[model samples]
Target: MSRVAPQGVLKSRRFRDYLFMTVGILITAWGLDAFLIPNKLVAGGVSGLSTVLYYTLQDKGLTVPVGVMMLAMNLVLLVVAVSFKGWRYGAKTIYGMVALSVAVDGLAPFTPHLASHDPLLAVLYGGVVTGIGMGLVFKARGNTGGTDIVAQLLADRSNFGVGQMMLAADASVTLVAALKFGPDLALYGAVAVVIMGRVIDLVQEGLSVEKVAYIISEHSDRIADAILHELGRGATGLSSRGMYSGEAREMIFTVVSRRELDALKALVHAVDPGAFMIISDIHEALGEGFKENGV
Candidate 1:
């Protein structure tokens, strides 16, 4: 009975994971079809190379759509991923790559020039849509499975980090674009890639950035009360021995949003004018009243 239950649980979890993966792939397809492809702005990884190749061939009257090229390129990269990174990593990437490829191809017929001639607007919208798609994939613990697999393999074998390896791969595509197209379009592509990457990081994490606040005050109880009553936040009290004075002290440890920092500081000041305080950014926070679990 116990073994059967475990198997059943595993199957359920796999089903849920597949659902999330499908959603991520669909969002990626929408971004490419609705924004990125329309703009001709290449982002980083295998998709970027596909964009470059699509335009290069289009000029010669032998056009291959970005989605088709992306599928082919990812298929090639999947071989390398399996050969170098072992079957586990390859297996993880294969489904996502195939799904994204199929989705992209399915979405290909609907691509229209939404941004027209406005390069800046194209870049902005393309970056945002691409970022959201990438964010969803990352949040699902799946890869777009482009050059990301190559990046990982290289990072494991070389001294470079994943980011550096990915940047190098994308830069190679941008260089190819510069040689085939003009430097201006290549530069715009680079900017679009950078913006998309940053936006992905921001979205995958949450909009409201967290900050850790430390407070040392004489009126610790009063400050804690204010934080609870006014701010509806929680705090932890720590007993500390002051290094400078060799005196006992009570410190408050709390986490708040960036917007709440000023209010927290004011509260500390109001309670104890001579309070010592420090604040630092917290990249991720998860709990009740904050970003929920698994998000």
Candidate 2:
């Protein structure tokens, strides 16, 4: 059977996407100003390049806003993104990139710099925040232009995907930053990169525990239907064997958010009190109800 969404649901989802991207831009800029910039840590991407150039020019009696540089560079890369990727891809990416550019500069002056002197703290916190912002962008099925666009372009012509391509491009930038800053700072920047990568995965996948429930009972259909209707989640029935009982069984499999676990339990119990039920942790759930497809 096919599930068709109502038009209102589609519109709501679109609005949610825009909100997520908007908040993501704000949070990412906050991270850049509050931690990365103060500590001179570049976590890679176009923003990282802008940070590096911004400081270099500053010492040479030139002052350019990091956000300005980012927008300029992103526009150059945006051309390539539109050329290689479709207009849909380019448009979504443009939203992210343009908003990010505005947010970084607009918020920088108001956002506080580091309060502590520890570079490690800056690296850890800054990376987490930036990663979170990027994760939100990914959740909206969008990408920020610049190296992300470049990565997609290269991935189009190469066997590697975006992650690897991003790493390669970021490495060149990191090396350049190291030359400008020093080996120690460079090492710290590398650590920030690693942390950022992990946090991106964490945010994209979610840090909270999700549950997958397996239920076996004569009333499996009743329980599954209850789950779907009450929870707004889909469930699948799979064939299974009970080796001890020498009987075939139909099992219901469903994934639910942690908050919905209790409701799911109640629904299952009400329908089939004797049902053999098992629930286990799911690290991540990606689909209609959970995470959207990422970049």
For every model shown, what is its TM-score relative to the native structure?
Answer: 0.85, 0.72
Error of 1 at 98 (Å): 1.2
lDDT of 2 by residue, 122-230 (tens): 8989888988888887888777787777887898899999889989999988898888888777777778889878887787766767899999999888888888888
lDDT tens digits, residue span 1-295, model 1: 4365878877887777677778867877877777666666666678777877787788899977677787788878777777765687644467888788788878777666567588777777777777777777777677867767778888999999998998898898888877766787778778888888888788777665788988888889899999998888999999998988999988999998888888998888888899989898877888876877652
* TM-score of structure candidate 1: 0.85
Report lDDT per candidate.
Answer: 0.79, 0.85
Clashing pairs in 2: none
